[model samples]
Target: METVRVNLGSRSYDIALTHGATANLGAFVRAALPKTSSVLVVGDSNSWPHAESIQATLTRAGLRAGSAVVPAGEASKCLERLAGLYDALYELAADRSTAVVAVGGGVIGDLAGFAAATYNRGLPLVMVPTTLLSMVDSSVGGKTGINHPKGKNLIGSFHQPAGVWIDLAFLNTLPAREFISGLAEVVKYGVILDAAFFAYLESNSHAVRTRDPGALLRVVTRSCRLKADVVEQDEYERTGLRAVLNYGHTFAHAFETCGGYGTLLHGEAVSIGMECAAQLARKLGLIGDEFVSRQTKLLDALGLPTAPPTRWPADDLIAVMRRDKKAVGGQMRFILPTRLGEVKLFDDVPEPLVRTVLESAVSR
Candidate 1:
């Protein structure tokens, strides 16, 4: 197992990455949260078996373990499902010590983590992210929330998990489109922070696409550590440093919201959003065609979309973007790239330029 520690003083935790099956999940949980006596495993329908296995392991370790399963999809991250999760916790008689293990993708993490954060004023939380997207990004950030009708992640909290357990075996079961969707976030890390890593992805694209164990290990390990470095500096968005992680999210979230949840996967929106942001950056003279070409080539090689779905009209997307959390005082902000390896948040973006990017939606 490879371990990356998120050093956040008292809120610090370890992200454990393993290739396939492993024993001693109980030990992993106990090591980080010895005080926990019981656990409520929250998973979606597709990941229930993994959740069942986790519950049995924890129960065998002499801790009470229970599980709740919701239908698998973006729709699951809603007020109705969140209320159901609260009911599950109450039925399990879970307390502050009874850790909530989010077993599945990003949706489960957000739903369960929100419950753990609010129920009984916060319960110990453990993340068992089974999807590549959640494994590399959402699982490590401690930013948990359910989506509201108006926006994505509109209701949430900064409740860090006690530990994160990642087993890449889950990738074997993920659909091809879902797996490709995940590469978008992986690409975002390279764009916003690591130049070498971007070049590495370009060179080793075949290996990662083939699911070579070594490439995946390096990819997930590096992505988690890069995020940890940022989260350590600004656990909340107070310092504006963490906002860089939202590089393409401003446009992406709007795409997701306008299409309604599940129309486009989160990472797909991120992929298209990155392209829009890059185009907007070019208009602002932050970078030229070369920078945009590099990102477009990588996104294409990974089978990600560079433009929002045509059905998502520019005006509708604009209205949604305006209501996005990143828009302060009804003004838009974006994390635009200065070059290949870094991104800067700009609050002075013009609406017409953004509209042009949205209206153009021409895939390279």
Candidate 2:
């Protein structure tokens, strides 16, 4: 197993990336929260089996462990599901000493993390991400929350995990579409922070899509390191430096909200969002035509959507963007790429230009 550290002083944690590390999960969590006497293993429908297995592993390691499963889908990330988690913890008689081990994808990780952060005045969290998206992105950030009707992740908190335990073995059963969906965030890391990672991806797209083990290790490890670097600098997003990680999220969240959460998977929405953002950047003369084509081709190669999947109203999308947390004075802030390896946040974009880009994104 390879380890990367999110150096947050006292709140620091380790991210373990390996192909078959599930057997040691108990030891990992035990080391992270040694005082914990019990664990609440949370997962969704698709990942329930794995959650149960993890429970057994923890129990064998001499800690009391129980498991709960939520319906698997984006819709589950809501107030109702969150309340259900709270009830589960209550029934479990959990306390600060009981670690909440999240055992599925982003939805479960976010929901369980939020529950761990709020229940009994907060509990330790150990993430066992079972999806590519969660492994490289959500699993490390300590960003926990559910979705709101108005926008994505509108209700959330920053309760960094005690540790993030990742095993690429979890990806063995991941669906093809879901696997493809994760590449969007992987691509985002390249577009926003590292050009070489982007080049490496472009060169290894075939291997990545084929699930080559070596390629996946590089993909997950590099993505985690890049994200950790950002989180280390701005743990609570106080500095605008962390916003660079939101390169396509403003447009992506609006797409997700307008789709009523499940219509477009977060990765699909982000792919489309990056397309619009790239177009907007070109319109502002920050990049040339070649750059836009390069980005679009990469997404296309990854089999992710490059345009809105449906005809969401441009005005409505903009309205949702305005309500985004990063917006200032009713204006949305966009993380626009200025080059292959760098992005910048822009808060002064004109509504007309935004409208034009949104209008241009219509699938047909």
Candidate 3:
């Protein structure tokens, strides 16, 4: 097992990554909180098999596990669904000492973690991320919440989990499209921080698509390391250094909101978003044209969409982008790459230029 520590002062925790970590989840969660008794195991229906195994393990270990399974989709992240989960937790009588284990992808993690954060004035959370995207990103950051129709992650809190358990084996059951979609976030790690990691992906993109264990471990660990390092520096996202993690998310949220949530998987949107951001960078002369081609080619090779299909009205996307929490007042702030390995937030990016890039990305 490869363990990376997310140093967040009092909120510090470790992320354990391995192939078969799910089998030993009971032990890990118990070790993290010996007194944890009643746990609300929140998962999506697609993840029920693993959730069942986890519930059974907890039961065998003398912990009472109550489950709340939601339908699998972005629609599950709603106020009504979240309220229902709170009602379930209340019925189960979950206390502050009780642990909440989120056993699915990013949607479940965000919803369940928010429940843990707000229920009974906050309880301990143990996230067992089953998706590649969640394992490498969402499951650790403590940024938990459901989406409002207005925007993604607009209603969230910074509630750090007790620990995160990453089992790469769960990814084997993921659909090929979903797995490929996940590579978008993994690629974001390389784009924002590590030039060498980007090169490695260039070389090993095939192995990743094939689900090679060695390649999986390397990419997951490297992505986690980059996230952990940034979280350590700015846990609350107040310093703006951590905003680099949103390299492609600015465009991604617009895609999700404008097209409706389920129309594009978050990672799929991000794949296109990254390419769009790269194009904008090139347009601004911040990066060379070669960088844009390299990004698009890798995304194309991975069977992920590199651009939005329809010429979505740039004005509509701009409207959604303006509503993003990262935006300052009405001005748009973006994490734009200056080079392959480094990205910086640019607040002065003209709205006309942004609209032009959005128009270009969709038209192409």
Which residue window of length 10 is worst by lDDT in model 1? 17-26
- Alpha-carbon RMSD to native, per candidate: 1.1, 1.1, 1.0
lDDT string for model 3 (1-364, tens) is 8899888878888899878756677888888888898798889998999999999988887889999999999898888989988999988988766899999999999999998999887999999898888988898788999998888888989999999998899999999888888899988988999989999999988998899999999999999999989888888899998899999889999999999988998999999899888888888899998898888888887788988867778889999888889998988888999998899999899788888889788668
- Give the backbone clash total of model 1: 0
The Cα local distance difference test for each model comes to: 0.90, 0.90, 0.89
Query: 85 in model 3: Cα distance from truth in Å?
Result: 1.2
lDDT of 1 by residue, 88-194 (tens): 99999887679999999999999999999999999989999999999999999799999887878999999999999999888888888998899999999999999
List where candidate 2 sits over 4 angstroms from the true fold: none
Candidate 1 Cα lDDT to native: 0.90
Tell me model 2's lDDT, rounded to 2 decimals: 0.90
Question: What's the count of clashing pairs in each model shown?
Answer: 0, 0, 0
Please tell me which model should have the higher lDDT, number 2 or number 3. 2
Taking the tens digit of each residue's C-alpha lDDT, what string does model 2 give over 1-364?
8999999998999998877768888888888888999999999989998898899999998888877789999788889988998888888888767989999999999999999988987899999999999999999888999887766788989999999988898898999999999999999999999999998988888999889999999999999999999999998898899999999899998888888877888899999999999999999999999989988988988898998878898888889999899998898899998999999999999889988898988842
- Clashing residue pairs, backbone N/CA/C < 3 A, model 3: none
Arrange candidates, best lDDT first. 2, 1, 3
